[model samples]
Target: MGFLAGLALLLLGLHLIGEGLSSVKGKRYLLARAFSRPGSLLLSGLLLGLLSGSGTGLSLLALGLLEGGIFSLGQAALLSLAATAGAGAWVGVVALAQREVAEVLLALGLPLFLFRGSRSGGLVLLGLGLLFLGFLEMGQGAKAFAPLLSLLNPGPWALYLVGIVLAFFLGTANGVAALALALMPFLGQGGSMALTLPLIHIRRGGQRGS
Candidate 1:
């Protein structure tokens, strides 16, 4: 139930962010110019992933940018790759600072949302807050299965299969990574690596197809 609730919050947050950002004037042109260079594009992708904490979220955003004429297909592909790497890089940070970030975003967003002119910005911040809160909830929910998971001596293939299914449902390698981090107390180092590796491959493949 907690996991499901977290998923709902995650989806809602992403949707709000998309809707809010889409309404921002001149953003498309600014983004297009910002991503003109490969270096800048990679950095931007990484920064986005770090902020959003979801490769799938980044992919969705890239797709939106592509449709908006702010990004070419090739650039979108590159951004997805860079963003996924960035999301992986953010797993530890998310584990440590999820609640704090969520609280900060909520504190800022709520007041800003009251103002008409800053509504879009407020929505974006609220979305970010929800995203982190969802992550925190999901982590807590996964703890319920820790004892059962610890009893299982699953092999690499089993772990990989589990990861694929999780990525499919969560729609992001980052989510899988975050979950794996949460389960590390049960899964241990080797199990976590086995679970995440295939999910990364799967996410990259999905990104390419998108």
Candidate 2:
């Protein structure tokens, strides 16, 4: 139930983001004007991910920017890389947050998800909340399987390989990273870091928009 609800909110946020970008089709050029330098573009991508709190949403915006003839394939790749890093930043922060603090944040944001009167901004908040909530539930579920996880004592290489696959199917590197962080005590630094690589490596790429 949490997974479905989280996915729904994620998709909704993506939709709202797409529509918001389309509505401001005129302003993308403004973005283009700001990102003339490679370093600047990379920085912008990181900032975008951090500000939006959604790498997927930033990817969609990057696609729009590409369509506007603002970003080349190489530039888009850099942007995507930066976006992933940005996402990592969020995951790190969340990993460091107290459990109670996270719950408070989720509770505070629930209304935005329930309330339909909000615009794109609210949708983004709601989506983030749902994503966090989903991750929370997943973490709880994983706790239930702790015994099974403990039985496996794979080498670092094997763990990384499996983590990549698990993260891929899970479809959110942040969630994977958060889980890995939670397991750091049991898995050690090497094993926990292994889980984070999948998030860094699984970024998506597509053709420059038509």
Candidate 3:
């Protein structure tokens, strides 16, 4: 985690922290408390979908917020599901678009606009920026290391599980997904993407419990 990756993680942390803090602050800031509403839930879900298009981090954040008493566990879980599903939807779109930066920016922009002017917005923006930059960095890094990605492309029935376990432990599904995508181009041309379903499902179930 260099400057960009660290920044993205930090921003994401701020968003969740702000949500929890805002809820804890109570009646003193009715405006801030508004984020706890149903609309906010939907927006948060969509934003989660857009950012990395992986619900793992969003779900974990929801769990943390719930634990902190920002939102009910049920609400947190529901939003997590929504966010994950939404991200899956966006992933399909991303695949079709074949333009990661454009797709990511579109996804993240909504939350920033919706959450703007609030205490959490500033940090969320920072995190979102970091995440976006990190995403670009990862993609560039992947392209630079094409031979390495090629070596990992061919599977031996273990890469799928390896990807999931690595993702879970690393706490960064983006990294896992990058590896998956890299391997995908070589997995019998159209087969690499097929593994994504099982891998994502595996990570999803484990992360929720975590």
- TM-scores for all candidates: the values are 0.71, 0.60, 0.53
Better of 1 and 2 by lDDT: 1
- For every candidate structure, what is the RMSD over all alpha carbons to the true structure, in angstroms? 3.9, 5.6, 6.8
Residue-level error in angstroms, candidate 3, position 121: 2.3
* Candidate 1 RMSD to the correct structure: 3.9
Q: Report the C-alpha lDDT of model 2 over 29-126, residue by residue, as the tens digit.
A: 77777877899988977866664455675666677777767878777677777875776587655544444654564565566547655444444544
Q: After superposing candidate 1 on the true structure, give the runs of residues whose Cα lies further than 4 Å from its correct spot.
A: 1-15, 18-27, 33-43, 54-85, 151-153, 204-210
Score residue 75 of candidate 2 by CA lDDT: 74
Judge candidate 2 at residue 120 and give its lDDT.
42
**How much lDDT does each candidate structure score?**
0.76, 0.60, 0.53
Tens digit of lDDT per residue, candidate 1, span 1-210?
A: 786677667666666665566563347677778789999999988876675566776677677888887889999888888887776676666677568889999899888888999988888889878877877787678777776776777988899899988888766566678777766777789888999988657756775676
Predicted structure 1, TM vs. truth? 0.71
Candidate number with the higher lDDT (2 or 3): 2
Of models 1 and 3, which has the larger lDDT?
1
Candidate with top TM-score is 1
Q: What lDDT does model 2 reach? A: 0.60
Which numbered prediction scores highest in lDDT against the true structure? 1
Tens-place lDDT digits, model 3, residues 17-136: 345334323442342265467778777677656644557666766766677777787777777777777666643443332335534644665566466455454444444444444444
